[model samples]
Target: MVLLRTLRGPAYTRILGIGDYRPARIISNEELCRHIDSTDEWIQDRSGIQQRRQATPDESVVDMGTQAARAAMTYADLTGSDIDAVICATITHPYQTPAAAPMIAERLGTKNAAAFDLSAACAGYCYGVAVADDMVRSGRAEHVLVVGVEKLSDYRDLGDRGTAFIFGDGAGAAVIGPSATPGISATTWGSDGSGSAMISQSVSWTEAQERYAPASLDMPGDPARPDATVTDSLWPFIDMQGPSVFRWAATAVAPLCERALAAAGVTAQDIQVFIPHQANTRIVDTLVKKLRLPDHVVIADDITDMANTSAASIPLATAALLRSGRAHPGDLALQIGFGAGLTWAAQVVQLP
Candidate 1:
């Protein structure tokens, strides 16, 4: 097992409550096949994604994030004013001017609360959770709202098979408060910036040509190589290195999982559930085999029904499991996230 370098910190921060919001409108694979050149069978075979939920045309990232925050605050029996801080994770926000988190706090009526946005790609929620856990544990804040919300479809190139079939829209959230024991036990986290170039969104400018500049959101194409003078033509859409990502995810997630389990002094058998990032079912299955955890460990994922919600995936699945009575109070649960940044993290948590 991988060992910790620093002594374990006190368990003073805990996840007190959680909530999620999925748009009422659903997008099925068959419907996508009609719009794009894809088949339900093919999409399932590649990513195990059968369908997705997308926000209404009128809904936006901040709106979804705010909505999820409200639900979490209600569950925590706290008002926006009660929260000392807020951290929102999203790759897609409506505008580049005003940060989404502060706007959400305003919408939630949190007075003078510190708030900001975070982007660790799909691994954002894990990172955010870790950040909030620390801030609260250090007595910097009492109650913090860590939100993972995304609207990937709004910027998607619906015609591309790789990305279109992989993303859906939704939001998930958690209210973290101080806990005495069995709260956030141990977490393993790391990132590789070199991999950040692999996935992104971009825009360009033209010399002395105002007409050439488009104000609308545009996809940032892949980075240029010195050897290849010819950069491919630009398109507005998402991109993925399917095979590389799958490999990285499978290999990257296992170590973090092992470390977190060890830190909690819990065996794999002690874990009541494993809520992995909802990037792909294939990756989850691969890790399940690698870890050799319990067959009844109760792995939860909603990608088949909700698609990949990026940072929102794990918390969304966790909340859904709780709502359905799958994950009960005080149960031992583990969560892991891995994606762009080539980042990954794992933490063992106790249900409140």
Candidate 2:
């Protein structure tokens, strides 16, 4: 019989640094009102969003992710060669074959890092963080780059009022590495497929291609509309059942957060900051009340200016919190992410 030697890692893992990229273009509620029959006041009252960022036509998910990754690496004092793996969490990467991770790694100058993409929808960034934590703890990788990015504007339905004002484009990245003390705690995560339809794409890729078949390809455009094209009909858009999602997020996620706190051996009193996914301001308010957190715990409200960036929300908000000096190194933060797939994940960590 042959015996194999095992590798040992550090005592725990911690997030070394964090960074994010908000698009240069801002789309205010007034501008969105032109396409949908919504008033600026009604939009603000409903979602607590005044404006959101939108990337230009030329910006791709990789471009935004790379910029964010570079910033995180710089904050961690790491170069491209220092990364042992890259995990990109996004559903908006256009290419279905080659994943976005390798492209980002190569662009960052990594010659041979393990790379892959994760599709957990809005729960993706937390999912990536958990996986990276495990990898470092197990000695499978020394340093991991986790990025959450989305370019939802490319698939948005301007005429659909339900989601037109809810989504924005952005990217956020974090570097996870070995630590002397425990910085990341046990994560509590789960999913419910029964509510999967609550949020989803308007059509499948096959359905979109079928709609663009030759028989329907050559239809004449209205004489009054010279800019109309066949490609417009083939693009899939995001769709959601707002009430159902709100109910799930507001009621169900609170208990999940409690479980995460318990798993980390901490209570609401020990946390200094709370960064939930920036899905909506109302949702954040409900969770805060449900958790009964003390007044000193600062809750992230980036939704007012950033809208919902899906997987990028938590880290983006984390970066904003740190930049504002509301959170400092070694401060305890409770982070939770929940969205499509009815998926949810939460954990407690010390701020970088």
Q: Candidate 2 lDDT, tens digit per residue, 1-352? A: 9999887788799999899999998988998786778988999999999998988767899999999999899989999999999999998898887999999999998869999999888899999999999999988999999999998876666667888899988999999999999999999998999998999888887786675434344754312123323233435777899999999898899999999999999999999999999998899999999999999999998888889998898889999999999888789999998999988888898889
lDDT of 1 by residue, 81-131 (tens): 899899998877756668899999899998889999997878899889899
TM-score of every prediction relative to native: 0.87, 0.94
The 10-residue segment with the lowest total lDDT in model 2: 221-230
Mark the 10 consecutive residues where model 1 has the least summed lDDT.
Answer: 222-231
Candidate 2 is scored at a TM of: 0.94
Candidate 1 ranges with C-alpha deviation above 4 Å: 1-11, 202-236
Predicted structure with the largest TM-score when compared to the true one: 2
